[model samples]
Target: MSYNMYLSALLMAATCCSLAISYLCWKRRELPIAISYGLGMLTGAFYTFGYAFEIVSTSLEHIRFWLRIEYMGIPFGTVLWFIMVLQYTGRQALVRKWLVATLMIVPTITFVSHHTNEWHHLFYKSMTLNYSEGFPLVTLVKGPLYKLHVYYSYSFFVVGMVLMIQMFIKEKLRMKKQVALMIIGSWGPYGFTLVYLSGVIYMPIDISPFGFIISGVFYMWGIYQFNMLRLAPLALQKVFASMQDAVIVFDLDNSLTSFNQSANRVIAGINNKWIGQPAVQVFSQYPVLLEKIKQGPFMEGKVQLAGHADEQFYNVHVSFINDKNQRPVGKMLLLSDVTDMVRSEITLLENARQLRELNTFKDKMFSVVAHDIRDPLAVLVNLMELMEEEMQTYGEDQQEIVNEMGQQIHNTFTLVESLLEWFRSQSGGMIFKPVERDLAQTIQINIRLLLVRIENKQIHIISEIPKDTFVYADKEMLDLIVRNLLSNAIKFTNFGGTIRLRADRSDHKVVVSVSDTGDGITSDQASMLLQEDYPVSSTGTAGEKGVGLGLTLCREFVHLNGGEIWFDSTPAQGSTFYFSIPTLSEASSKQSDSLRGGRA
Candidate 1:
């Protein structure tokens, strides 16, 4: 009715708009609790708006309208205030619904009582004036329902306040204190209303409307200045930490301001010591860390450290925290420790190595098969040519010639059978049955198997294999690896050159070094031999053909047995292929442990 109430009405509109914007922001973030707080604020505005719009003619009607308007906020403010409690305290209210229902019932009865004699005086008295610019005061009277309204109204306030207090006590104080303060501070509106209602401070205009305006303003302060409801800061901190991210917050002058426990542990670091020290001093143990941070953010690469720790990678995201004046306050170093990622990278590299070695092994097998097949085919062709010559020379004894030719054809068939068997195994079409056997015995078996080829090449075989060594590996896979190695050794070595089998147990594993005096590989070629990919096979010295599956199989088998396989060679000097397998004693009964050791 008056200018002051009109002014309060305008303030309510402004409050509503501002809070709506905040609510929108909160909705965008999917924060239902913050949105509820915003709704609480808007409801307070509606309470004020109701007072400003109604020109009450009497005190009873005035009180009734005011209480109804305030009661409308009961569900919104009461529920939302508890929602805030649930957000901060993670505790739900036990009596929230009852409090809301009681609050709403008061106004509903008061609204309905306007038609009855008992209700008549509750809202208004006798018609004191037909019309007036100002509302009249009522000859106040109270009934049971009026008392109920008063009871519920005060009960609503008490319940809301108590819940807010509980939330304050339950939340992390450092981060949530400002929000608690905002809740406490919002009591100013109700306090002023109480003062006005009790006739403690009488003014021409109702001050309760202004009270809502003030409350709304305080809420805005909480939202804008304090970030009271933004859990994202704390949430992000937790998420990053859980993700194994190392965070370091720096102050204005480039000092280490704050860092999580992980950050301290990640560097050759200490707890608490890094808080006030210069960033350079703290990261001095890991000098490259500063360079990574200085690169702005988001560098995914390896960082070499001084200690024996493995090389790690970091994906850094740097942020500059600014002061209230919008000046740069400090830099935030958010480093996601990608040691696992680095390990993955290393695994990929090893896989490439294994794949290349696999290709080389297949090539070796292909060569061996082609050679064995070619030798037989060549002999068979020559035998046929000789038989043709013999058929003409000794036409009378053709039966003897036919018998010798049949034996030659049978030898060729045997060679073809061996080639086919090896091919099937190389193609993953065959599974090996590994039996635990002495390493010395396996070496002896291979030596005997390659005895004919070794003798034909005129190579001197030197056996320095240990007598008691043992490994649990696929017997067939081991045979193939050793046989191919010896065959390649003999094929490439000069006549009368030495081929040595040096087997020893070292590094908790059986180390087998097969060295050869041959036209060996260069360092560069050797690096790529088991390291990179080239689909085509390189020709062997004896012009053999096939995949180098033997070396690949050896590497794979060594891996399966919890060991390693590699090669060290020099051009034209010699070549040595080294493979190691853990002793059978090392293989555990735990299947998962074995999986990790063998397959991880």
Candidate 2:
């Protein structure tokens, strides 16, 4: 083989290296730095391969064909390298879409000028084979556009070199070696290209393609040895240093490796000097944290630290850090300040305890007062009844005055009884013990108890509930519901007005209703009454007073018994209040099914 053939073989070998590195780097294309560098290497392979073919060509036509092939990689190589430098140095944010397009303009013009050089002669003034060198080689008389392409390519190499140099000067101690290798690798290509362009070396070949072999070797070493592109320490370091959480790194030996600025500020006795110290020694003041770190690779818990002024709380999280091979190399502990959250929870717990105590005291006070006043009010009502019987012997006006006094005493007695019942239900003193009972009999019993009031109002009542209409409910709660609803109906009905009590079965439930023919409530009043909270009560037709506790108690009891209550009121016409309870047979069947399910 001749000297030119040996050079061609060397170029082919370099092309193989560039292609291999391109494939390896492209595998990690998720990283912008890796992908851009990979593309640069791929174009380098194309340029080197075309140069190998160009150097061995015997004819001018074959030489020109190889030259055009070289242009395919030449236009893209430097632009891609410049972009890779920007990303590798953590300046990728400056690579906007418009900026990239603008950079491509000169390369695009260079490619077109070279390919159509036969028409305009702008890329080369003349092209011929120089046989004087023993082997035929393509020799070109440089054109004006050719110089423009040379200058443009040199500009990118210069900029990329400056960026890599700047990064080397500022990089961390451990990363300095990697950056140094990168600088040397990138500078090799520029130096070789300059030597060829300046005619400093008498070489048959361009000599620039060999520079890519240097780049591939150094870049491959940095990738596998220093984990340059895979780890991306330059980009991640910026984010790690700016975190709000205090982060501490530990090696496999449990020695402190590094810590962020936040760790230095928040943790006492933590400083750069503590690096390489055992975790136990560094965390001597925080025994709990040290113990947790020793337990395993992963841990999470809350720790309280005593500050100079007050106590501070932090949520500590520890996780293992794995290398590229997924082997555990170190662990990181992240401490996030949660003092405000902890203090708020503590304050809420204290307030809740105080609220519970206040509720218990209020319930006790209501019980004592209701009991003391209710007994006396009952005795007073009985005495007034005796007085009414004797009042017939007095004058007409004196009898009227006695009757009014008796009505006031009765109203007071009724209010006291309601207050006692309301307080008991609210305090959970009323336990629900449901049993099957005849619902019609329950209604009749409440009516008999309120017979006197019904007679006084001269209201006519119709019972539509059939006999043996049974339902499952707490007996006392059921009686209270029937009595309150019946009394409300009687109070609202006009003199000699009609009142109806009805009951019907609906889907395993018995629905009961008490209706009255009186002036119905407005929409606003209906909304207020339906709410579970304390609602405003109005005076009845007979001047009877209330506080709406009866409706609230009814809703609570209905929900506890697995039932529902509702009402329908037509303005200026009348109102009907309805409530539903489970039927006796249905309730028994459900209880039996529940027992069977539990056994199964």
Candidate 3:
């Protein structure tokens, strides 16, 4: 066999090996990195196969044709090699679409230039046939554009090698061997190309294609032996490092495997040295955290860390990691700093507790005072009645003075009663006991209690409420609300005015309204009447004294009964205060009765 024949055979064998490897890799083309490696191998095969044909071609024309075909793969193969390395190292984000296109542009231009080289001589300055080593070899002097292509190819090769080397150094022990093989595979063609470019060999033949055969063999070994294509590189490091919450991962045996950047900040004394150590030993300084881990795989709680003047709070969440078969393999703990939220909640709760205590004390004082004065006031009222009976024994001036004193005492007693009721409601001293009660009956009772005031004002009381209407509310609360509203209406209305009590029932609730045709309130007064903190003590149309506690108590009772109260009023047009309470549904009433019977 001729020397050229031997070279052709060698190149053919290399091409077949590369094509076979490319086919095997293409079978698992779902993996992007694997596809890139396969493409590089295929391109290398093309270059070698075309060069083999070019070497044995009898005519210069045939050799030139084969050389142009070879140009198609030469530049593209180098770029693909760089891309494969980048993808394998989990740095594929750097190989953007535009960057890949940019890399291809030069190779595309080179291929076109080579095809039309005879016209411009931009790819090859001159081509000649030389008889050396008893075989025909095509020799060419490179053009300026060809040198540029060389530099471009060499840059990619060098960069790819550098990236692979860096990855090998940084990769874990399990991955080091695979990365090392990849580096060796990549270096073969690059080393030979460097040797050719440096003029280290005087041979007319370029041996870079032979070097690619060695590269293909190594790559195949990595694919089949190490399962390199199947294993995904550690790509979550970027995401893990950027997390704001501290994250720690531990193996099933309770040994710390990994942690994020924020872990050290959250757990003082934490460092990289903690990796691969037992979590209990590593977190020994943080007894709370260590004890929590010992509890179980799932834990959620808060921890307080001692600080200079206060304390830092953190909310921790722990969960177990499961394998594909749903077996527990590890656990991950996430700690989120909640110092601000904790402090705010604590301060708010303390203030609320203090306010509640003060309100309770105030209620107790009022209750005690009212309890003491109520009996004496009743005695005084009885004594006044007896004095009125003996009024004929006195002069007209003495009789008038007696009547005035009785009226003052009555008003003072009413004010004190309203104040006591309001204090009990505010301090949560009143117990709520809701039962089925007739709405009309409740209204009638309140109207009877306020009959004296209604007669004094000469106000006509009209009731439009149905006799069968029922509601679900505490009886005492309902009584107080009705009494206060009726009393206010009678006080505000002039003599001969009308006070209307109406109720409208829907499927779910009953709306009761007390509307009076009296000297009404302004918008501001109406708004202030419902506010608990606003002090509103305006005199009635008849110059009656008020402490402004009636309406405040009414609003509180209405809300506590799962109801709402609002008023519509216009200056000099009278006011209508409306409140809604849930109606007694037959199903709910029956259920309550059944429960009561069962309890009894």
What's the distance in Å from true for residue 118, model 1?
7.7
Please give the lDDT score for candidate 2: 0.75
Q: Ten-residue segment with the worst summed lDDT in candidate 3? A: 227-236
Error of 2 at 125 (Å): 2.1
- Residue-level lDDT of model 1, residues 427-449, one tens digit each, is 66344444677877877888897
Clashes of 1: 20
lDDT scores for all predictions? 0.59, 0.75, 0.74
Distance from true position, residue 65, model 3, in Å? 1.8
Q: Write the per-residue lDDT of candidate 2 for residues 145-248, one digit (tens) a residue.
A: 98988889888888888887887786556657878888877866677888888897787667887787787788778766765532232223556778998988
* Candidate 2 to truth, TM: 0.50
Best by TM-score: 2
TM-scores across all candidates? 0.45, 0.50, 0.45
- Candidate 1 local distance difference test against the native: 0.59
Residue 260 lDDT in model 1?
62
- State the local distance difference test value for candidate 3: 0.74
Query: In candidate 3, what are the lDDT values of residues 389-491, reduced to their tens digit?
Result: 6675653445565666666676567667876665565455444567889999999988898898888889999999989898998787788899989988888
Candidate 3, residue 504: Cα displacement in angstroms equals 20
